[model samples]
Target: MDMLDFGSPRQTYDIRVEYSLLYECALGIGAFTWDEVHDKLDIGQAQVLQIKRQMSEALRREVSLAGLHHTWRSVLFLIHRCPYLPSTTQEKHLPVFMDWLKEIKDSIRTEAAPYLGASYQAPLAAALAGNALDMQKLLDEHHENPVIYQNLQYLFAVSAEQLLDHIKRLVEGWYEEVVSRDRNVVATLEQSAAQTSALSQNVSHEKLIHTVTRGGEFVAEPGVTTLWLIPQVSYRPFTIRNHLPGYAVYYYPVDPDAQTGLDKNRLISNIAAKHKAVGDVLRVRLLELLAASSRSLAELAQAIGASKPSTHHHLLLLRTAGLVHVDGGVYGLNVDEVLALGEELCRLLKLDGVKAAQETSQGR
Candidate 1:
């Protein structure tokens, strides 16, 4: 067997920022969590609980029936491939999105096939055919140790048509019950998209991704022709990454204050926050440890000789300052941001001075 090359030439791909209400809705649904990690979310536990309580029973039932509470990431596979006009209203696109899902139901399994291991062909074929016995046999053959197979068990058990219907209902219900009422969220998303799109035009792909994701790095991957940077609010402070056949999607968190109109004080405060985040000896040590390698919360806490809560607090500050990032339950230092701190500070200070001079001239 030949090993596949994962690298692609830089010129082969372009990055763009996109706005989609349906995509945001999908992400918002995924962000709903009841675990201890809910504290890490921008919405926080109280709001999440409120959102759950406010949901209609029918919508709640659909979400529960489809196991969306835990398996919501699966919906992104379909969302990434769905054909819809960019920045269109969700109401207009929901029906079209559902129709497209139904249309592709027969071949839906193929979208996920590439991500699975080489041994997945038999089970994937069985899944597509809705053959329970064959799927069981393949699962036994593989010993079912593959996490992807476990994650997608529901898809294998039902026909694509049935699975998509469940998805359609869950998404539509989420929109009607939760998304529709939050008109301000759509405006925020549009503003975020506009801000990011403008920045993308002015910056390199690397810089744009780092700035938007607050510390993410996007390495070129084979076969990906475009990188979609979709701004999202529901999962603020965390970025969700996904890949399709020809594109890479990053549903990155939007800066809440970016759309709130910038002022000199706000700019200065933002710069100060970054400095303040690194002002502590313990925090600096944490960064040193992360610089060496990615570490889990427990590992980081143990290494720094601090309680988990204290370490989590320090990490939260570092993360907010764009100096750290957690992926796959491990925290890694964003070395690029750390190295460019001086340059970033100077850039912001110069902009602040320019803005102040303009304000003085305008007599604001």
Candidate 2:
């Protein structure tokens, strides 16, 4: 007889919805750093420029002095490293985060020393660890990688203490001047998180992640046991993925419905955008290839006989329309969204009246 054996229990994870005004404060500042040609930021260029101009001279001076526009990603690292407690306000967390940064300033410099002047791909983990990388080399080597190389260059030039001080002042000033003025932003973030939390209760983890990220997939690695889903409006139209020790984090775009509350015009605009995305012959061809199988930019370009830039532009439109999703650099069609187009149109036009009438007639 075989020995009696008990198998190991399967590892599982819990998804938690969290929101903080601090995140919005940092991301709002980061938004100014986005490049028009590459980043698909939902905020119009004119709006972003106008917002920047509206900032107080002191706040604007700190932003420029700290080179926050170049090293803006550093603020994200600071936020993630800071311990968070649910329901804590930005006021409560800001001082604590700054103190923590002060305590670890030396260690940050130590960790960063090895990478300075060395050629390496700038990984988010490394950046979070305070590494000062060689941006020029990174650009030369990985031309296609979408990173603000100036971030690394700025890190290399500044001392860790200086960097931390600059970031602290910038964040505090931002919260006071920008975030505090708009109480509605905090309410919006909280409402979005609550709505997403409700949806998560009824959906499976995979389905919830896919829906929230607009079709992006998540594959857990070993020892990961929790997912932190944060709904944000500052980084609208972009779902940012990040990681920390034993936890995977997603700062996803808030749903339009949560923001606008059943506005028919917004619905119509969304439908029109989707139709426009599919209108181009080249885009249709790109979708045809993606429908058959997932592909990379180079692969899709070759398949459609288009240049990389042209192919990327078409794919961007499809992605903005929710018909395409890219995960880990591989592009795939969002079949569910594609299939729902007809139903969406019908609902928008109130054609559901016919179905309701037929159902009423056939009812017992």
Candidate 3:
């Protein structure tokens, strides 16, 4: 695959930051160690074929390049481990766990050990118990191995690089099938490609990439360092690389100031401004403590390293901004609003009971 380097730092940071949002959502909701949510994820043999058909059929209809890019990445993501797709609606359109349930056990072992507790395993087992073949087919078709983590009642595994390749092929097969069946979809896609590409030498110094390709195509690549590529040369980057069937190359950086055409600072400034209301060091610490769980006003103040009266004053402000709310003598973040933010907050903040208890004692 031709590695075109788009030399821009601010742009790259922008892309990574937005991508982080998706990852955050996946980590938060998808990783919920609860039992009820885990029980419904059953990918029977027929369902697996359906997933293949939906994607294959979509391709036959001239899949939107943007949709295809995200879909391909989603396939890669599922293969890695089923990720929890966050949604605000009451009902989920797709099973959050899917075939990825088996990988959850390893993720727990590796990434979430301390905070996850043992509550997650039972639900996880419930989710994966019936789907015996989805992940196996995913791994085998992709030519990768699921790392042998300890066996829970369920088998969880993922293949990193190869899975990505698998997604690429699926996209290609769909497109080929579509071109044979429907001429319009392919023609419309060609005319509306996301970016125009030509051999351009002018690029920023930082936005450089090295890779190999056949007549300009991104081959199956295993990221940058872990595996080395030969015949490496530099070029410009494009989404759904030129003439390379199914190879969608996302630029590492998105323009921070311009997403389609908007200022990043403008988008985030108001949020930063709200920090002032609950943004004070003491207020933040105290609010964070309450957010972790319900606590007495006195408890929060101690956690904030302040006297009860001072902390109480700050909590009042947080409540005003709709960041926190008080019930009787206890304080807490509005759980409804917090949950509405999707599962991303699980990492953005941690719930700490010790801080609250300490603060409570201090207030006493």
Candidate 4:
């Protein structure tokens, strides 16, 4: 029942680093907020607004008819197989990608048919619902959402294929115009990945992941065999995931403005949240109690000598700062993350490095 458990790691000889034009386009299309597009992206405000207008004009029919969620859902379904996607807009890979889409459609139908609604279109409907691409949840949702599953199948599927050429063009053009121009940013990302991997060769998998990714740690689950560490620019400071048993992909974001924005580092903001979480003596007592053993919210409230709502609010802050994690109904301390807070603070302040070397170091 654990959503994070996706079997064991698969044995792979090499760790790969690659950029995705598809990822950038997808984020621009639907995932990113207006503030993120204006501030986080390297594009100028006028240019960004122009592109948005063009994109809106181009996809107006689909957006109007099917809604933005369905329109973006089809886009993601086409491009979600990122590891297999070509690095550039090579026309040769287009067919290969389309064939993979058909296979995905087939897999959904076959795997989901038995549990899904009796209607023939049930699987395709669920696929088009455009939920985040968590495969485990995809399989489980027939039980969880039978009505939405059964009703919405054919609405988007009919138009999804027709919009393929337009989507392809949008992705390719955006890559050429916007993403490719940031060659130095891309190069720095590749170099950083190599250095992080080298540094982690002697370290534990979890610690290495934490050091490299800032917040996310690697999990050696039962069926996961390979991990792809892809670096993304538009989706800064979040470790996005597409998890599977043998193969998993984590999209770690890169700052668009590498010099100043990244130099100041957002981890300082997150670290401040961490400080605020434990700033109250009552919350500190709650963390201490949870460190010994996992406890329910009521139990934590009783131990902390605070009301349930107050204790729950304190726990929410800790959870937001990634200092605590919930498993089942039991709240447990994220012990390593809590411990690494000081180390993170030291790294942020440049106190962990040698004096001369410290000045030249980027935010950890």
Q: Of the candidates shown, which would achieve the greatest lDDT relative to the real structure?
A: 1
* Residue 85 miss distance in model 4 (angstroms): 4.7
As a whole number from 0 to 100, the lDDT of residue 132 in candidate 2 is 40
Which residue runs does candidate 1 get wrong by more than 4 Å? 1-12, 66-71, 87-90, 105-126, 130-147, 261-364
Q: Which digits, one per residue and each the tens of the lDDT, describe model 3 over residues 1-364?
A: 9899998554221111012222222222221222243333331232222222323333323233323222333432442333343322112312333223334433332221111123433444433443456434433533432121122111233333333333344434443332222222222222212211211123321322221122243234322211111110011111222111122233222222223222233224323434557547777676567667899966766666788888777776665444665555667666543343333233234335556777899994
What are the models' TM-scores? Answer: 0.60, 0.56, 0.24, 0.44
At residue 53, candidate 3 shows an lDDT of: 33
lDDT of 2 by residue, 1-364 (tens): 8887798876667888888777877677767655452246665664355455445566787777544434445676566666543545645777776677777786553332222222232453355454445344444554454344555545656777777677778888888766674546666777878888898889877888899989988786765678899888778888887665567889999876666643465567767878999999999999899889999999999988999999999987787677887766788887867887787899988888878888899992
> Which candidate number has the best TM-score?
1
Instruction: List candidate 2 stretches off by more than 4 Å.
Output: 1-11, 37-40, 64-70, 84-87, 108-149, 261-364
Give candidate 4's whole-model lDDT: 0.55
Q: Write the per-residue lDDT of candidate 1 for residues 181-282, one digit (tens) a residue.
A: 555666777788888878878888888889999999988876778988888877889898876656788999889676455334445665677789899999
Kindly give the number of clashing pairs for every candidate: 0, 0, 21, 12
Give the whole-model CA lDDT for all candidates, comma-separated. Answer: 0.72, 0.70, 0.35, 0.55
Candidate number with the higher TM-score (2 or 3):
2
- On the 0 to 100 scale, the lDDT of residue 265 in model 4 is 48
Worst 10 residues of 1 by lDDT: 110-119
